[model samples]
Target: MPGDGPRRGDAFEHDIQVGALRPAFEAAGLELVEIDWRAPLDDFEGLSLVLLGTAWDYQDHPREFVTRLEELGERGIIVCNPPPVVRWNAEKRYLRELERRGVAIVPTVWLDDAGHGDVAAAMNQFGTDRVVVKRQVGAGGLRQHSFSRDAMPDQDWRMGRPCMVQPFLPSVVEEGEYTFLFIDGEFSHGVLKRAAQGEYRIQSLYGGYETDFTPSAEDLAGAKAVVAALPFDDLLYCRIDMARLHSGELAVMEAEAIEPYLYPEQGPGLGERLAKAIVARL
Candidate 1:
């Protein structure tokens, strides 16, 4: 099996996700080869499973990147979560599609550019007293901001390029956000992510913290339904991030299919389970 790359640093040296999966792959008689996702297509041939590990640069060059992935797929390499699913889920626009399907989601507004018009009016539509402005395509909370109407500049309302605006749900300060992990469409484990004091974003790389969480039955049911409704069956892994709405409804914040942190440290046998799932598919 091939894992996606720039396989450097202590990111995986003590990483729970890597620690769990590596031994299991070895026991299952699979060679886990880590390759740079941007390397020549020849590097990906002969792989049984290809995971799009950590290469944020691929997002910047998605067209050329996915073209290479398509080539590999055409040659019969089983890319976990699939190239199509990765392409679709990479953008936050999928939230609109999910909302259309009756799944509850955080209130969101899409803007074309950072300077179109009427940011206040859009924020009002969501009844947001405060809101977050973020890039349409981003990771690690880069370039995201939380703002009250008074804090927004007049030029910030433009919509020339796609961007996102979401009501800054304050529940993040109390209950935090929950991320549920799934393997082969089944619940594996979960983590609770807390933004740093007085901050709204909950990415560990952005000063957020996480711990193992035991989800409620409702949480599990809602999460499973969301996964079931996704338009794919061959997914290898997924992370469903959720936060509670003011009215107490669970709302999806993000659905990560590519390169999401799995927090394998939370469970004793998670790595073996993931390995078995992949082996079963092979």
Candidate 2:
């Protein structure tokens, strides 16, 4: 696992996942090593599999980080989900492609420093009373905000960073968020994430809670289609996050291909299943 460092006190999820995965890999005759994701690229040599685990710093310098991984891929190193997958998934614009392919996705508008003026126009088209403005490339609910149509911040807010504007779906408050965990394109488990009392972001860092959830046949089928549409042929694992729209339709919120938190706390054998998947790929 390539992360910041050894798990700390508040990082219980990180500890549990790394701890469980380490023993599972050992029992299967594979040696598991934990490295800092921000370590120099030179350290990756001789490593068989590079799991792009957590390193918030990498997300901030994604282009450089992914470039290094791509170089490693050229030498036949196996990077879970792969570098191309990471490059594509890192940008929020991928949502547009999914929508064009006939997948249901939350309506989104992209804004760079040059496109700040378009925010109002785009939000008007989505026809929502409130919209969410978030950095185009971010994780864990960092730098995300909700704003009413009449209360957008000044253009200075978009001066140095690219942002995405999406209409706030009221259904998030009513039906909670659903995340489907898949290993090698097959269903493993699902979870329902409820945000803290009045917040809309469902990240645990933001006081959200997740519980094992069973999806309806329709929800399961929809989630499957979203994953199947991705271009990866050897995707080791992924988490597909979704939320209901005002029209009672499921829409893709995010496709977490890099270091998504797999809620193994929900079941006893989930970690074992994931280890088996990794072994099959090896």
Candidate 3:
């Protein structure tokens, strides 16, 4: 697996899945080595596969990251989730494409370049007083911010870049978001993630907590449709996160195919299942 090496301030250096997944790979008769993605790849000559375990810092240097991934592809190294899937999922605009294919997505108004006036326009377009704005390419809730039409607009989240704005769904606070885990298009497990009290972000790094969840039939149907609507179907793994809106319908919060945190706690031996799925892909 290609991952980030220990750094003094690297937030994902302590990812537990790296260690947790080692045994599964071994059991599958494959050798697993965690290599620093930024380091030289001279030692990976015999490596059969490269799975992105926790290269969370890819967003820090997206151009270089994509370049390296392309280089690996040119060298005939197998990359899980595929390069097209990574390129598409790395940006949030994929939600719009999903919506076009009849997948229910949280209502969004994309801005090529957002300004204070654009934020106001987005609120009007969304027909809501409050909206959430986030950069097109980001993780860990970075650059995500909420703005209220009643209060001063905080366009800082845009950071003078392309952004997408959506209505703030109260469901995120009222009831947690549901995440459906899939390996090779097969559903494996589900988890419910809730933000800390008085918070809106549901990432564990932000004090959010995840718990095992049993999806209702409606939720399962919705999640399945979302996955089916993906542009590509041979993804090694995917995590579809959805929230129940006030309208009593589920809206996709994200259909992450690239490096989503697979909550192994929800399903014991999930890494084994993932390892097997990856091996089958090869």
Most lDDT-accurate candidate: 3
Q: Provide C-alpha RMSD values for all models, in order.
A: 3.1, 2.6, 2.4
Extract clashing residue pairs from model 2. none
In order of lDDT, best first, we have 3, 2, 1
Off-target runs (Cα >4 Å) in candidate 2 are 1-10, 114-117
Reference-based lDDT, each prediction: 0.77, 0.78, 0.81
Backbone clashes under 3 angstroms, per model: 12, 0, 0
Candidate 2 versus the native: TM-score? 0.89
Score residue 89 of candidate 2 by CA lDDT. 87
Q: Per-residue alpha-carbon lDDT of model 2 for 1-282, expressed as tens digits?
A: 344456533367777777777777787787877777656767777888777655545668899878877877876778887888889889877887878778899888777742435666667788766877777788777777777757876765453577788888877776789999998788988999888898887877678888889899999999998897786767888899999987777899998887787777764566677778877777
**Highest TM-score model number:** 3
Q: List the residue pairs that clash in candidate 3.
A: none
Runs of candidate 3 with Cα error greater than 4 angstroms are 1-14, 154-158
Model 3 poorest ten-residue lDDT run: 1-10
**In candidate 1, what are the lDDT values of residues 1-282, reduced to their tens digit?**
124555433255235666677888899887887776766888877888787665555556767767777888898998877889888877888888888888888888787765524467667788776787776777667667777777875564444456888888888878899888898888988889898887777876557788889988988888887887677877888988999998887799888887787777766677777888888878
Worst 10 residues of 2 by lDDT: 1-10
